[model samples]
Target chain A: MDLRDLWAESLAGMLARPVRSALTTLGTVLGITTLVVTLGIAATAGNQIVGRFDELLATSVTVDVPPSSRGPLVSWDAPGELRRLRGVVSATALAQNEESSNLVVTANNLLDPTRVFGQTLAVVAAGPNLPETTHGRLLAGRFYDAGHVARHDRVVVLGEQAAAMLGITRLDHAPAVFINDRAYTVIGIIGDLRRERVLASAVLVPPTLGPDFGLKDVTRVLVATQLGAAELIARQAPLALSPSNVGELQVIAPAGPRRARDGAQDDVNGMFLILGLVSLVVGAVGIANVTLVTVMERVAEIGLRRALGAGRRHIAGQFLLESSLIGLTGGVIGASLGMAAVVGVAAVRQWTPVLDIRLALAAPVAGALVGLLAGLYPALRAARMEPVDALR
Target chain B: MPEPVIELTGVCREFPSDPPVRALSDVDLRVEPGDYLAIVGPSGSGKSTLLNILGLLDRPSSGSYRLDGVETTELRDGARTRLRGARIGFVFQSFHLLPHRTVVENVMLAEVYGPHPRRGRRARAEQALEQVGMGHRTGFAPGRLSGGERQRVAIARALMARPALLLCDEPTGNLDSRNTEAILDLFDGLRAQGLTILVITHEDGVSARAGRRVRIGDGLLTEQG
Candidate 1:
């Protein structure tokens, strides 16, 4: 018979043993599902990491003296030292003070001591491009202008969530807030920060707000490095800092959010790739076993067909078609289930489930290949059956 | 101007068993077009081997055989299969219709694998079934048919190819007397239609209906009628 008839007959025979066929296809499904899930999660996490890197730092470094080290406060005179280093473009020391208390955020409202930070307006080199609030206004005033910081004015900016919590909608009205039981007038709200790895919540105030919190000491030194040297600059900070103050020194690098997150993402992707490959191999083996059994079970029928004038290619095509169908079916079902699982998990954990082409395409192609390889031995065996012995 | 449909001379076949049995020895036979022949032999008399060689399903160890003037002994496997599909039709003792197919489907199977595989096989299969008095049972599965009805389907299948030689290897071996008579009557009708028929059997009833009988014993032909 022609190849089409052979395929029809073989498929009919396969359907005759529905349990066996389903069991055979299960191996491929497991393989493809593992592959899809592994690749999907890895890809999503990679995208998030890369997105975070791009958001946080295009090219800059921040240095901190951590609490673990015993440090007498080093003078903020290192701006010149940092400029002398290779690839150093510019530098500044930014001090931040945070104070928390139940405060009158609106006419009739009080807000919890969500984080409040103060920095020099000059230290925010990127202006509104830097992390800013996304919601209600820091009304009745403006952001910390150079004049406000120079005068040490009692001004505040509300964050998006902070502003929403305060129930303030009018930008023209000044709202009063209490920090460390001291009253400050709300000026401008920073709106929303870029949705990155960096904190998306906080209120911004002038460095003049420093003494309000106990942070009369230097909080952070924001250093701007030349493009492409941020990572190198971050690496060299510990060595250049005074040796005796090692305990109080920490280097924070603001890399292009995408690049920093990409590094971590590679590891996750690599892990999932290994998981996917292992399962695919197992799936291929399972398919091979099932196909071999199928060939053996239909030995007599194969012989009869051959004797009746079926060509060797016809026999091989029949088996290949059967296995490929099984693989394709399993791949479709498994991928759909995998996507559902990803969505379910993301919903439970409160994260975006990233869907992309690589994950979507890899499963069926890989599964189909596995099935073809699995069918290879069985198809060859069927093709090689001697019509004489087979007919017997 | 019609050609001799089958010719064999000094044909020998050896089976490589534990004792190395010789299944056929120096067999010489010929059948003209429209000949009706019966090959009669007891068990182990090499009748099956001779039938297989004649059917082009097996090659003789040392023989020069011609099928419709072509030297079949030297033909390659593909050429032999082509010849078999084009020129030979088989009816086995067990009435080996594919168990899953209906009567018409089984009959159409021959056309599916034959040299000139028929298109629109349904119409041709129905016609063939009618020729064997099985047209009404064409839709029934072989499992659902009686033994006699199944044999009729097998005969229909054989006739579907319209081969020059119809080979029957113990066609009535598995049937009751009524089924045997029915099959014999069908054979009588085919012979009248001028198809070359060879029926292999050890039963006298099978040989009596044939125009000629050839008896094989100890791998040798001893009598001809």
Candidate 2:
């Protein structure tokens, strides 16, 4: 039997029973829709998590004084020790003090007080070569030049959100802020980071004042590693600075955009595959049931066709085609619904749901397979029907 | 042209009832190409039984039946099915046209089973409908047609395969006289085209139109005319 004719006749027969055929396909569509929506939502959540990894500095190692540790953990010694480690490029100690924190002003009118790190600005002597904030950038004032760092200038630059919040709207205008009841002038405002949690609240401080404002020692040390050596550097720092007082010191290798993109891609892809499989199974069951009923209802017709010279293969082909058509139609509807659901849910949840190429490739394949699997039993039964008994 | 299209020798069909009823007994019959034969009997007298056997729809308990020179009793189920599909066309009294299909589609079903694939089945089906003067009613569903019209469509469907033998079981049992005559006329025309036709009926008028008539009573061949 030519498969084409079988397909034609089967489709025509199904169209003849529009209501039953439509209802049968509806089952598959619902199944596919559920699969798509579930996968899409999961993928969206996964992408967000991966993106958050960068903001939290997944590759950066944190050194903190644990309450259980015996020694005085806060000090300027950690940065120097960490910098000497094999992969470490440079290390800067950061201390937070409520007083002596003043807003820094540059040639621009931008003013930022909270940017003060309350330490010797010597770290700024590293100049622009210092690591750029992945989540934000300097917009107006030049970062503390070598002169400003050597002199321990009380200048600071505000992040874009902080500057805007502080009403430092004009480029040449210096805005002032109150820090721990002390007033400081804003020097300049920085722009957005590659990834930022809250843009409007930020500060740039120097690497000293470890003992000032109740800060007995350095609370945090920002360490930059050589290119491609972030992970290696993070790994070596703990052993090099093995101090008993460090609390929950974690090593994080800050990942770039590529890693985040790959993670998002993987999550979206995996979910779509799972959803595709689920939809296909449901479609197959529907197809099988429909074919079985079709065989039962058309027993006499089958008999007549056989008596007219149709072989078992012919009968099988016809029924198989019918089921395949149902599957294909359901697949199309399911795919469309799936995409829509993803978009809709993303919009509602305020998430970005990416469309993965793998999902696009899987929908049709799943639909077709379901059709074939579902039709197998019914086609066999139709082929085996007795011409004599069937006509009765 | 000289050979008999259907031949039977000592054909006996039995149904396992409480007493194992015999539906056909020692039936010997022959029909040349173009012959119109009618078998008439009461409901339980085995007329339908003979039709079923001749249609290759059922096997006789013990008998050697030949159709178009093939010994049917020795054939496998698949072979028998193929033979039945290729050689036999049935027109039931009830005109069992699929209710969901259009008249043309019903006729096309015959071509679907014919030697041709489904590709050319439609044209043959339409041609068969035209033969029965049902060309215009091709789009109408069987449920929408009258009893006579439905039977004609069934006849067209039977003819669509161009079978060597046409088996009609009470073709006019459900039709009025005028519709009955129309069917009988079509049978006559088909017979003139050198087709072997076997019709089973209780109606005397239907039997009278055949070239030869046989009577069965209680599963036994009783007479011939």
Candidate 3:
């Protein structure tokens, strides 16, 4: 038979049992839909995760300055120099006195003469840009600036937890916290530290009081860079801090987010792709089963065709074409449904949907291939019947 | 003087059962162009076997059967199928009309597998339907047609390829006397138009309408006077 006639025959055969054909196509639709939905959702979710990662952990770089025998390894003004480098959003130097954690702090020593409110709190001295470097917010008052550090003023910023513990809520009356019996005015209360979370429960003071607090040298410099510039900034921060002794400062920068994002996406794709293929396999089996049943049901028709002089290949071709057409139809429907599902879910969840154009185009062809394979056995079986036996 | 449409010599067909049943035993037959011949026999008389072998639907255990100058016994399956499609038309007792198709579409199916050009197949089908007086029912589905009408449609389908021979097996088995008489008259009309015809049936009335009749019993054939 000609191609046109073959196609017409297949179509007529399918239309003969409309409900069965539709049910058979449904199997392929589900398989392709799962494939498109999973891949699209994985891509969108992975991008969102990487975006959040880039905003926080991927941008922060810390340079740890270990204690050196040659006195202070990093100068207090080294943060200002590192901040001059490209891609650096903010940089701050921190010094913690070894005995500051052991100091007794009191909210009101004069009111409580028995020292009933004394508590041991860590005191960390930082540069003027501590709030910017740590991505922290000031809950009340203001942070100490360059003037406070240069003039050696005894002003401290209380961390959220520390301020609560010392019963200092309002700075209206110029609240003071005594550290080791030395009174220091509270300038600000800093909270919500995205980086250096340990600072949330400590007292932050200017670096000029490091010697008085027994902080011998600058301990670390916290640097925040622009997204995708963390690794470059990490390498350059040590050289910028102490050009002569860059080896003394250890820089800790997070691994690139691209690799992590790809790994996550691959894992997601692998898992869902298998499920899609399994569903496709099931759909293929459904087509095969239906085609076989159709072959069995049309035995007499087959015999009549043979008597009319249809070659075995022609009979097989007609059945194979019918199944493939069904698969193609299902694939198109499934691809559309899958994309719609992805977009719908993304819309509901407020995510930007991601779908590959190639995948969309390939889905139907893949479905057709599945149908072709599924119809092979049944078509062969139909073709193998002798005209005499079939007619009988 | 024209070549015989069918020539069968020493044709034998066997079924390999536990006892090896011989369906057609050394049956020899010949049919000329424009001939209307009938092979009549009761059940298990090898009538169907002879028809199957004549239509190239079955192979003889040992024989030489030639159709239209082609040694069909020596032909490959594809060649045999092509030859059959190009030369022979079949009409079964049950009509075998596709119920889902219109009468015209059923007629058109006859040329679908043949070597004929498909460009004007519908026109030809309509013309053949007209020849069998089923032209008016071209758009009607087979389910809506009477037994006589359905047989006429089958005849129209068989005539689509302009085949050299029309083969019928119990053509009026399911028809009432009136429809049977009508079908027998149609066969006579087809024969009058120079078409060779072969009918396999046990009915005396059906065989009496043919120009020649043969009797077969227990895998053996005998020409009737």
Candidate 4:
């Protein structure tokens, strides 16, 4: 028979038992739907994770400076020099006095008998660009800048937790905190430190006061780069800081975001792809089972066809075509349902939905292939029956 | 002298049972074009076996049978099937009409596997239905038709390929007496049109209507003088 007639025959056969055909096709539909939804959600979730990684960990680079006996291991102007390097968005140097943690910090001095509060907090001196490098914002008052550092102004920025402990909420009256009986004006309260959580509780001062605080060496340099630029900056920052002692600075750059993203995506894809395939197999089994049962039920019809001069191949072809058509139909519907489910989930979760066009295009074909494979044994069985026996 | 529609010589068919049952034994038969012949026998008389061998649905264990002068015993399955489709039409006792299809569609199925061109198949089916006096019921499904009407539809299907021979197996077995008479009359009309016909039946009344009658018993065929 011609392809057109074969297709018509298959359609008529399916229409003859609509409910059975639809139930059989549901298995394939669910399989394809699961496949599409899993892949789409995996892509979207992987994208979201990678985006967050790029924004925070991937862009931030830290260089630990070993203490040196020669005044300071690096100059106070080292941050400015490193900022000129390619991919460096912001750079800041910090020097922490080793004994600052031992010093007692009090919101009120001993002379004030009304309120006496003391706490031992680490004191860190940083460059004027500390806010930008730390990915922090000044919640209250202004941050100390180059002018304040150049002038050696006794000013300090309180970390969010530090300010809370010091009982300082606003800068309306310019609160003063005493460190070892030396008072310094709190210029700003910084919060939302994305890179260094330690900075959220430390007292930050300018690098100019490092010597006064017994912090003679610049301890570390914090650098932030653009997305996908952290590794390049990590390699170049040491050279830019001190050409003679690049090894002295240990750069701590995060692993590549692309690799991490792909790793995460692959893991998700691998896990859920199996589930999709299992569902698809189940669907294929359903098709095979229904096709087999149909072959069994139509023995007399098969005999009739044989008597009407259909060869074994023609009988087999008709059945195979019928199953494949059912699978193709299920695949289309499943793909559509899966995509809709992905979009619906993403919408509810407030995520950007990601879908592959190629996957969308291939789902129906895959379903048809599954159906074709599933129909093999049953079609062959139908073809193998002796015409006389079948008629009997 | 034209070639006979069928020629069988020493045709024997055996069923391998615990002790082998011979269904047909050294059967020889000849049928000419435009001949209305009947093979009458009771059940278990091997009449069905003879019909199966003649219809090319089964092969005789040892013999030579030719249809339209072509040796059918040595033909491959596909070639045999093609030959059957092109040259022989069948009418079953049960009518064997596809209940899901319209009368015209059932008729059109005859040429679906035949050597006939597919174009204008519906027109040919309609013409065949008209020839069998089932023209008015061409659009009706077989389930809606009476036994007689269904048999007529089956006859239309059998004639669709313009086959050289019409093979009937108890064609009136399921029909009432009136319906049986109607089918017999239709067969007479078909035979008058120069169609070669063979009918297998157990009913004496049905066999008496044919021009030539043969009785089969115990795997043997005998002519009725």
Candidate 5:
């Protein structure tokens, strides 16, 4: 018989008992559904969580430069040399004056001792690129530039929180804050520090004016590199800053976002792959059991067909087609349900759903293959039955 | 020079019991077109075995079988099936229609296993049902039909292939005497139209309807009419 007719007959046989067919197909549906859901959520969650990680932590590197007792571990011109390196967005040296560690910082020169506006805030000496390295924005005037540092103009920038605490808003008046008894003019307010959020409440100044307030050596070198460039910059930062004592400086660079994303996807898929496979095994078993029962139940019919003219191959082919069609139907239904579940989850969580189209496309084919393999033993058994024996 | 529809020479069947029981031995039988023959015997006689060998359902332990001028003893499994399907149709006493299929679908099942299967098989099946006087019950499942009606549908299924030989094994065993007479009338009508038919039965009344009668006893064949 032609393949079209053979397939139609097999389909009619399956349709004869609708409830049994539906029950047999359920196992495959659950298997395919689990597979799709696991993969969908893995891709979506990985895309979302890693995207933010790439933006905030993955692109920033911090190097702690220890004081050398007699001389600075890094020179003031180190940032200039490092900026010429590839992928270096900004590099700034941060240091604190030794004597100002215990001094109270204030924004207003109020004579009354009972009131405190800007106190216990850290005062830091920085190079020109402090705002860029921290991924912060100026809410008021521009940050004190190289010109100010070169001129030793004693200019300072207040962090957003520091300015709020001290009641210093607009830099149109050029407000000045005091550390102990010394005054430094505030030229700008830095806000939105993505990395190193503690800097949003500090008082920032150019390093040229730091020695007078007892500042000695650079303590921290904050570096912001381009996306996916943190690893290389982390390896090279200490060497570039201190040619002889690279080991003394500690470079703290978070892992790359691409790596984190891949790792996350792999982890999620690894865990769920087992569940998918277990479900598929259960499905295969169901197909095998049901197909065997069908063969047993239809012994007389099979024998009569054999007597009429059906060959072994024809008998085997009919049963195999019967199972594969069941699997394909289950796979189609399961895939749609899984995709809907993933989209629903993403919608609830406010994430952009990421789906791999190839996975969806392959599921039905996989299910069909599973059905074919599952039907192999039963079909062979049916085909091998002798017409005389079956009829008896 | 017309070829006989069935030709059997020295056919034997041995059931491998502890003491190998010989069901048939050196049996030779021939039936040409328009022949209506019946083989009858009591239980443990070789009538069923002779019928099985003739129907191509069982291979003889030794000897040759030719159905419609083709040597079947040496034919491969698939070729034998095609030869049998094209040349032979069977009707069992129990009316072996698939319990789930409608009468029309049951008849079309023969066409499904035919050499060139296609979509227009329904028309041929309907025509076969009409020939068997079962056209009115085409849409009914076998369970819904009475014994007589189900036997008619089975006959329709048998005739759908246009086989040269209609092999009936106890076709009237489960029928009432009236239904048996009716089925025998249908068989007579079919034989009158030039088809070779073989009936295997244990009842003398059933064997009396055939044009020629043969009795099998203890694996031996003897012509009775």
Candidate 6:
């Protein structure tokens, strides 16, 4: 028979037992739906996770420079070239007061702030915009200005914890602390850090004070960037800053984007793909059971067709086509359902849906193949029936 | 005289059992073109077995059966199916109509699964329905029809292919006397049109309507004078 006749005949048979056909098709629908939803959501979720990773992790790069005893290790204006690069939001050079490590601090020049909360920590030399560049909030009092740095003012701003550690919480007294027998006024307190939490334990000073403490060179440069620009900045930062001694600078960037994306998708697809296959096998078994029952129920009809001159192969072909048609219908419905589920989930979670076109296109064919294979034994049994016996 | 449309020689059909029951024994039969014949028998008399062999629905053990000069007993299963499709029309006692389809569609099934091109299938099916006097209810499903009407539709389905033989087993078994007389009249008209017809029935009145009659009993057959 031609394609037209074969399809028509199968369609008629399927329509004859509409309830049975629908029930049998449900298995394939669920199976294919699982597969499509699994892959689609993997792509969608993978894309969203990578986006977050880029935002929080890839955008922050820290370039650490080692300390040197030979004059100065890095220029005081080392961030000038890096700050001009695209995607770089802010860059700054910083120096810690290593010589003041053992010094005691007290508010209002008290021998020791007996109210509590005190520690002997290093003092840091910072620029005028240190609080802003470091993503810290000023809780009380104002930070020192450029006039302080240019005039070599002996002013200080305690970190959040440092102020508390010194038992000084208020700015009303215009608190002053003595280090190495020199008095410096605490102008402000900085806290709520976004970049570095370790900065909270340190006090702040002008860069000019570094020379007196033998802290002539800065320790590290911190650079904040736009999303997805870390790799490029990591590659170009060393070249831009002291190209002659780029080896002494260490640029730490985020993990590779391609590797992260693959790692994410493979993890999602691998776990769900096995579950989807199991569902599909269950669907195939359901089809085989339903098709075998249908064959048994249609014995008299089969005898009639055989008596009307249908060959054994024709009998087999009819049942096979019936099952494949059922599978095709299920596949179409399941694929649509899977796509809708993915899109709906993405919409609910506010994620951009990423669907693989090839998976969508192949689901129906795979369902039909599964159905065809499942119907083989049943169709054979139907074909091998004896016309006289079936009629009897 | 034209060569017989069906010929059976030394035909024997035996069911394999612990006791080996013989359904038919060395039966010889011939049916020529335009012949109207009936074989009358009680239940279990082997008349239906003979009809099955003639209809190519069953094979006769140790026999040579030919349909339209084709050696059918030696033919392959596929070739037998093709031959049956092209040459034989069957009417079962139970009115074996596919209840899901309309009467006209049931008739058109002659070419639905067969090798015949579907070019003029509908027209032939419609004409065949008219021939069986079922034209008025062409669109009705077989389930909605009366027993006689359903049988007529089945007959129309058989006739749509215009086979060389019309083989009916208990054609009027389920019909009332009124419907049976009408069917017998239609059969008479068809025989007058030079169609070869075979009717197998246990009813004496049904067999008496045919031009030739044969009696089958205890696996043997005898002709009526």
lDDT of 2 by residue, A110-219 (tens): 34565542321111111222334233456776555446555655555555655554456665655555444344455666675543333234555333312223444444
Kindly indicate the candidate among 1 and 5 with the higher DockQ.
5
TM-score of chain A considered alone, across all candidate predictions: 0.60, 0.66, 0.84, 0.89, 0.91, 0.75
DockQ of every candidate? 0.40, 0.49, 0.70, 0.60, 0.77, 0.51
Error of 4 at B209 (Å): 2.3
Per-residue lDDT of candidate 4, residues A171-240 (tens digit)? 9888888887789999899999978888888999887877767876788999999988999999999999
Residue B61 lDDT (model 6): 86
Tens digits of lDDT, candidate 3, A270-388: 98889999999999999999999999999999999999989999999999998998898899999999999988988998877888899899999988888999999999999999999
lDDT of 5 at A319: 92
lDDT of 5 at A213: 64
**Candidate 5 lDDT over residue span A282-349, tens digit each:** 99899989999999998888888897789999999999999888888778877888899899999999
Worst 10 residues of 5 chain B by lDDT: B111-120
Which lDDT value does model 1 have at B215? 94
The lDDT, on a scale of 0 to 1, for candidate 6 is: 0.84
**Cα-based TM-score, every candidate:** 0.75, 0.78, 0.82, 0.87, 0.93, 0.80
- DockQ rank, highest first? 5, 3, 4, 6, 2, 1
Query: Cα lDDT for residue A272, model 5?
Result: 81
Residue pairs clashing, model 3: none
The top-ranked prediction according to lDDT is 3
Residue clash pairs of candidate 4 = none
Model 2, residue A252: C-alpha shift (Å): 5.3
Give per-residue CA lDDT, model 4, range B35-82, as digits (tens): 999999999999889988888899999999999999999999999988
> B80, model 4: CA deviation in Å?
1.4
